[model samples]
Target: MIYTVTLNPSIDYVVYPDEPIQLGQLNRISKHHKYPGGKGINVSRILSELAIESTALGFVGGFTGDFLKQQLQDRAVSTAFVEVEEDTRINVKIKGESETEINGAGPHITPEKQAELVSKFRQLKQGDIVVLAGSKPSGLPGDFYQQLIRLITEKGASFIIDTTGDELMQSLEHQPFLIKPNRDELEELYETVIDSKEAVVQYGRDLLNKGARHVIVSMGKDGAMLFTHEGIYHGSAKPGRLVNSVGAGDSMVAGFTGTFEQTKDIKEAFRYSLACGSATAFSEDLAVKEDIEKVLQTITIKQWEE
Candidate 1:
């Protein structure tokens, strides 16, 4: 079984203003929508689109948490979130001339609640994949993710971490099954600018040397590259308008991990990763099966060479 952990989930409230947003003024929106918002949640939602069953695990609370849970349930996604005292956060995304976001800090998780969440992982067995994504809520220990990784590793289950900076760097030592870091995050990780494909390949290989079993460096419209012990592969989707970029990376992670888990084909997983990401980028929300199928028709993968 696959499990996705979202330590801090939210209700992404997207509002489209009739006109450009003005500062410190009464602004009105033409339309709005809300959905469960968290990196891990996005992965689970995308996995569902591929007919892959994954249980979402994380912290959720209050009326807001209730809504987020129902949203996932409505989408036919299973969840096992720990309830907290404070209400789950609401992130406001203003889509005007450009997208602007105001994110909430999320609820504080007490140690008792933290231990309760950790106990759930003890049930995991070999062949299980746990995807740990998004940021940690306030008041938890800094090593919270590391603690979970230890338990997961001890249980013989694999993990995939989608985060940045030190937290991401720290997870590398555990030899995660996969890690998807974008071009910018890559540059930030090594503190060097990637001006050419060679630079991208260099840093990507460095990540592999550092202990990542498989590394995928996403370069947005420029496409993505997959680095494995066997060889390197690259693929991209045909050009299309960008509607939303919120869950594109999470969609890619879900695509590659779910497909590879089932088929164990790296190239096919890379292809689906590109298609899933592109489909999501071209839609207002995460792509569905039909959308993924349509985009998959335009995807092609080839050996990446200098």
Candidate 2:
């Protein structure tokens, strides 16, 4: 079974306006909708669209938490998470000429509540893939990913981590099975801006040297690069217009891990990942199986010789 962890989840309330807004005038919302959102939640949603079953883990509380779980259950995705004291937060996304996001601080997980998560993870055995996705909530320790990686590794189950900045930097020592960092994240890690494909691939190898088993540097629209001890592989994105870039990288991670869990072929998995990402980029929401398959047929994989 595949498992995904979303330490902090939120209900994304998206508001769209029909007309331009005046500086001092009150703008009326023409349409608004709420969706279950979070990096891990998006990953699980994509996995479900692919006909793969996955269990979502994390801390949820109050009515919003109940709604989030109901949304997931409505989509046919299973979840096993602990409850906390505070209510889950809601993020307001105002879409107009430009998108504006107001994110909220979620519930705090006490040490005992956090321990319950660890105990739940301990039940996984070999062949089960665990994905620790997204950032830690406020009041949680910084080394949270590091701790989960160690725990899953100790249980003999391979793990995939998708986070950037310090959360990713601190977990490198655990040597996760895979780590997906986008181009900006790659630049941040090396403290240098990458201008060419060669520089991106080179820096990807640098992460492997730092103890990451496999490093995937995702370049939106340009595609993604996969670096391992074996060699460097490049997958091209299918030609498509970008409707929404949100969760595209997370979908790539989900597609790669989801396919890898079945095929275990790095290159094939990357191709599927590219398609999944591009598919999501071409839509306003995460891609479904048909959406992903359409692009999968056109995605081309090229091997770069060092």
Prediction-by-prediction clash tally: 0, 0
TM-score of each: 0.97, 0.95
Best by TM-score: 1
List the global CA lDDT of all models: 0.94, 0.87
Report the C-alpha lDDT of model 1 over 80-199, residue by residue, as the tens digit. 999999999999999877889999999999999999999999999999999999899989899999999999999999999999999999999999999999999999999989988889
Q: Which stretches of candidate 1 lie over 4 Å from their true place?
A: none
Candidate 2 stretches greater than 4 Å from native:
22-25
Q: Worst lDDT window (10 residues) for model 2?
A: 17-26
Per-residue CA lDDT of candidate 2, range 107-215, in tens? 9889999889989978989888888888789988877777788888888998888887887878788778899999998888779989999899788888899888888
Error of 2 at 219 (Å): 1.1
User: Would you give me the overall lDDT of model 1?
Assistant: 0.94
RMSD to the true structure for each prediction, in A, is 1.1, 1.5
Best by lDDT: 1
